[model samples]
Target: MSNPNLLVLATGGTIAGSADSATRHDYRPGQIGIDDFLARIEELGIPANLTGKQIANIGSENMTPAIWRDLHRAAVTAIGDPVCDGIIITHGTDTVEETAFVLDVTLPTSKPVVLVGAMRPATAVGYDGLRNFANAMRVASDPDAAGRGVLVVMGDRVFAARDIRKNRTRGTDAFAGFPRDAVGLVTPSALDWFGAPWRMDETARFDFSADLPDVPVLFIHAGITPEYVDRLVTTETRGIIVCGVGEGNMPDSVRERLIRLAQGGLRVVRASRLGEGLVDREPEDDANGFVAARALNPAKARILLQLLIAAGISDPAAIQSEFDRR
Candidate 1:
């Protein structure tokens, strides 16, 4: 049997970063090219037939909605190609969760679409990019990986897009699945899965052909004034996600302004500041037109809200239903 034909869309991150000193960690991200990256993977004799394309060679922290639109369009084109059996996205760890979630919610596929990144630069002696790339290809080639939405392969752990989060700044184990555990695990020798592949979000695939509306996230803190909230309530802004204290709470002064905005038909999501946990809707939430972010962090909540608002779905119940499902 022939190996699975994988189409790799490279959006450079630490995996493509390079440094002059192998001992030092300081390096410039996105210095390597797609050909070199794919060649390194082939040197390891990874079990796949590989083809590569460079989408954007920039740091993931610099990831924007425009790059996401192009990435989605390329993936869709690859999905339709008879030669492409699977798709792999080489992204940076800083914003992989956002990118994965965007693809998971907006791009549906029966074929595997795995996202992978590395902590160390490509030039490091302990360079993790090749191993991560190999494992990502493994997941993409695995028959069971199909229909599992978007997957992130990082440091032996494989996370589902809906639950993936970047947990730390500098470490091999930077990624994790919050509230939920990893869907699979991979190594040079073996592959193990905890569950069967399932559809991600079935309601709709959000169109990213145009510019997504600006929906800012406000991370609340002690002494954060209502003046901050007022800045987000502009004619051009669509929605807001407050990374509130405790159970998505803010000072009454700031809360009042958000409530007024929500009551006036603006979208407001109350997402927690913590890494993992649910922010359940309260009676005041329904009364004041707030959407509880459930288990979503502020970053993920912002993306969902942007997609919702861009689609012109403003009904609080309908938006809440999406926050519930997507």
Candidate 2:
């Protein structure tokens, strides 16, 4: 008979932004406080007993792995609370995918963790943050939303974290879920569903107590040099992710250097710079013990590699198996 208790974590983004005028482009993100943001949501009559906190007030571009660890710890503690039925995260669109991906693979709970954000400032005309926030509450309160890992809600579209990427710069429909359709749609009267539901919580192998290892991503281009590879190796970098031109292919010189590093016990992941596609193993990559990132983009591939290394799985074959997941 009681309403679901919701835990909302506001990590400043456009949803909490303030512009002097509705049409003005100049504004400050996270200028609005969490209580003010929730007050408007409550006025819309979203049926939940809301409890929240402002975890951070920076734009998503400034997101760090330290904050990610803090978020995971907060989420774990909140989910373990008997009074909390679900969780929502207000984040900036620029790096929501990365944050969501980290939480999706690290959190142990099946309770819904819905991340929502706006493409426009809260003070802007045609502001969509309130609507998106309300929809996030509905999705979070729904029992069906459980066991789906972390979900990103925006523009009435719902995407699983592992499959989501920010595809537009200014549009309300800024997110795109590649290699998979959105799991649900927020209709005027109901939440419509489609496809089978899957989550990474059951099989996630990670320990975030240790900070994400130093793993830099390299975007391959014409006339690449082996010197870049030499720098990382000499510096004792834990891992490297190469965003190659196509199907995860790098220039001949760079590929040779990557092979050399892999042979020398450095973990290397081959990911695609192109959007939407799997980077499967090539015969040559396998021969050199380089791991293919399969469907993961370069950024997400880097996140996974950090977890893999931190979890103490350094073998190329074992790391490749983790990336091969659907």
Name the top lDDT candidate. Answer: 1
List ranges where model 1 is wrong by over 4 Å: 200-204
lDDT per residue as tens, model 1, 51-91: 89999999999998889988999988887788888999999
- For model 1 the local lDDT of residue 321 reads 90
User: What are the clashing pairs of model 1?
Assistant: none
User: On residues 228-269, what C-alpha lDDT tens digit does candidate 2 reach at each position?
Assistant: 777666565888999888888888888888887788888889
The per-candidate count of clashes, in order, stands at 0, 0
The C-alpha lDDT values of all candidates are: 0.86, 0.85
lDDT against true structure, model 1: 0.86
lDDT of 2 at 29: 86
TM-score of each: 0.97, 0.95
Worst 10-residue lDDT window, candidate 1: 200-209
